[model samples]
Target chain A: MKKITLLTLSFTLSLSLILLTTGCAPDAKSHTGGAESLDSGLPSENIDATSILGAESGIAQAARPDGINPETDVDYSILSTETVYFNYDSFSIRSSERAKLEKIAKWLTDNSGKRLMVSGHTDTRGTLEYNRGLGERRALAIREYLVGLGIAQDRIFTISYGEERPADTGDNENAHSLNRRAMPGVITK
Target chain B: MRSQYDLNSMTKKLYTVLFAASLGALLSSSLFAIEVEVSGTKKIAVQISAFQGADAALAQKIVTEDLRRTLMIDPVVSQGSYSVAASVSGGSLNGKLTDTARGSEVFSRTYSGELRKMAHEFSDDILESLTQVKGFSTSRVAFISGTQGAKELYTMDIDGANIKRLTSDKSISANPSWSADGSSIAYMSYRSGYPDVYVIKLAQGIRTRVAGFPGINSGPVFSPDGQQLALTLSKDGNPEIYTISTSGGSPTRLTRTRGTETSPSWSPDGKQIIFNSDERGSNQLFTIASAGGEPIRITTPGTYSAEPCWSPDGSKIAYSTRTGGGFCVWVYDIATRVAKQVSPGLAEDPSWTCNSRHLVYSNNGSLYLLDTVTKQSARLDNGLTNCTEPAISR
Candidate 1:
């Protein structure tokens, strides 16, 4: 009876070790094809907290008409200088545009009640659906920067206009460069 | 002697006429029956006779134009293999199609409705009888129109008639996708000053916000069963593929990658979804189970491919691939695993018609239908400027 008890203990220990390793390891199936790593390397607790906050804020926004309308409802000119531009076919924050986002992040912290709506735009170079996705990634990149600087994830909303709304409608390179941008507009509660 | 020779020559002439007449009758009854051919290059020669009665000429004109647009029939004045006889009177149209070579009536029907609609019906019937394939005459296309931020959603007939504005939102709208039943359209609109997916039931004019995710609710495509929608949502961390109930509920994420995923199209069986992803570096096509699984890449890396749409027959996928400085339409055969470029110049947003052989895509601010078999394309004149992103009902 004592030998049987010892065998059960060993089996239990091995099973627990396997479970622990798998639970701690990053998802192997998700990282196939040598694709970019899924981890953002951010604190796990921080991500969980932000997700919970995001859910609560989503519910609150759903209870009311929270988004801006008519393009005249909000005075976006206040943060006009903070409109960050991106390179062609890219969403990475350039070193030149870092200062603008930092200023906007500080302004958001100072005005705690105000939320930021990052409207992402793209040039008319790619397919419309793909551009919409690209524009979205650009806006999310800006939001991530702000969130990294201590702004709450729930306070920033991102929208992609794609190539539909352009800052300059000309077909020249000058217009395209101006069109690929992420504009941070302040929305009051 | 000369009179005797003339009598013999006359007898021979009489015999020749009788023999020729008998042969003609035999050919008409047995040899000249029309059979449908699979080749797209050969079009049936159809002679449309002017109709008789009130508004008969108008009916003739409408039918003629509709038949010409099919690219399967060649309208001729005479010596046609087939002939159409139609008459419009008292809000009804009496139409008849005859096999000219066989000298037999193929079909005869009476249609009553709007003159244009009745004519379209007759034309469709003629095509179906000749080709054994359903006609696209009654099909409608929903597209986005207007310049800059003032774009709105509009629907019109395949021939560019009966233009109807579906949305008056002075805000921008993009990526209009049709439900399989053609009763509703789901599109991404910025009317709320944010990109949100909205579905408009064409009959009751009821609009519902199906997806209002916090960040980037775009590229909404209805499943084949119409019970769910596959879309790209970035509400969770990064842009990912998700499926949500058509009536609006919690979205089920289908893809997990650091790359951006968009343009999700469901297979005909509704089991698999083909979408565009940049997970492998460049935008390429990938297929994943609708329920959620690891995505298998469909296109070669290093080339940009996007806006994928599965053909109705489940045999092929039509998408736009980036060519030297411009985009071209390509159809990828699922079985053979071969991709063929079907368009010559700049083309994007390819949506397949119900026939699956033709595609309606936007190029240079206009929509064009391309015959994949023949590689021939015809511009669709919607009479609207700056039109793009065309979605045709199956």
Candidate 2:
């Protein structure tokens, strides 16, 4: 009995020692990783927190009604909103933009024969390839949302322009926010 | 007797555990081993002697500028550690590099081409002789230079000379991929009122429609072997990376993820591809076999990384990551899994020079070179505005 007890005690102590060493290993790795991040000069957080003002100003301009006027030849009011704007580096539909997407969904339902193309775009801030991906996500998010609202998936097509097409030419935050959007266009064929 | 046997078995087990633990430590420590030296940022000095014959001044001036743009060397007025002498006669030029410090001839070669092209060749040869590194002087940078509304494909010499507009499609053109031989460039344009991938053979200026799928056809990159092109297409639903023969056959899908995937860069071995995907909600780097398989995410948490270009040595992946205020060029060491930002400014679209020591990226409508070891960024002087999407040949 004594021998068995001793064995259990030794095993527990050994297990704890191994656990402690293994736990400490990750800490050391994370410490070096933290140092590398600092050394890379890419501060994880915003360097100039004031840059938010520029972005917010851009968002404010996004509220303006321009860039997507209905063609005088067209008779339908299919698009209540010509474009759906997204936040920086995000594809999640803003709560405020949900209603506009619903209207687009209703219009698509009304015109079953018509096809809509959602072309995604991004601000000039991120890498071109990433922005293209982000743009696609934005367009997909809208497509998925419209599909959820009973719009046929076949009626909707999506494309991501990345940063190739920007609605605003300025480099300021206002322009960037305006540029990061998904424009729903009527496609023939 | 039974107790004695039990004790012996326990001892054997303990020895086995000890052996395994030590082996694991040994394996892991070596696996994570990385040697990153913060090397000298100082430029190597080289003297460009006046060319002896025809196109002498032009040849001398371009070679001097070419070396200066390296961000690794400077042009000295007199003799330095290295000196280059060239003689241009007719369309042929002979250039020689001498190591002044050792008073020994390094290399001598004759190149036959245009006046400017011959000078570029000499600059590249001299650079290779001095540093044992391939020079980008003779390489061309294909990029998009225009407003967001109006964009076109433009090619310029690495020294920012010989600005040639390759496309007049009067539509948006983005993501120019240079061929391995530097004879052609492939890019996606909207000339057909939709995105279509086109290859422009530089010498003959012949444009071939390689891909015009039903949906998105963008981010076309030539494979290392030059036989296949990896690009992003949304024809099947979401944007995913696919590989198609440059000769225009059906594309074989590489990534099956529902997430958007773009910017596929080939590994030097042509066995794997590194591309950007938002599988985790934000953009990150992922690698998949060129033949198609499960992808392995390469980047760590904290930043949005994209546009990955694998190094020629396959030791690192140079990409642009979203930093605090802007994007910066960073290199992710494959062995250590450690990322080091090499550019200090807002830079994007990084492509490695053939030497793999330096990368050229665009910052604020201009292109710059960043040395991975020294972490020095120098602007490439082409004097063009809104130059982005820089693709370096070799």
Best candidate, TM-score: 1
TM-scores for every predicted model? 0.80, 0.79
Error of 1 at B262 (Å): 1.0
Whole-model Cα lDDT of every candidate shown, in order: 0.81, 0.76
- Which clashing pairs does model 1 show? none
- Per-prediction DockQ comes to 0.12, 0.11
Worst 10 residues of 1 chain A by lDDT: A45-54
Cα lDDT tens digits, model 1, A1-189, are 445687789999999998888754333333212222233222322122322222222322222136465265555688998899988877878888889988998898788888877778899887777788778777777876787788887888767778877899888899999999999877654
Model 2 regions more than 4 Å off = A1-82, A109-114, A169-177, A187-189, B1-39, B99-108
Candidate 2 lDDT tens digits, B5-108: 98899989999999999999988776655221113566777888878997798899999988877766789989677888999899899999888899989888
Instruction: Quote the lDDT for B81 in model 1.
Output: 92
* Model 1 error, position B116 (Å): 2.6
Q: Write the per-residue lDDT of candidate 2 for residues A1-189, one digit (tens) a residue.
A: 445688889999999998887753334223123211112122323222312111122211111012322222222234625588988877778788888888888778787888776778899787676676668667767777777788876766666678877788788989999988988877543
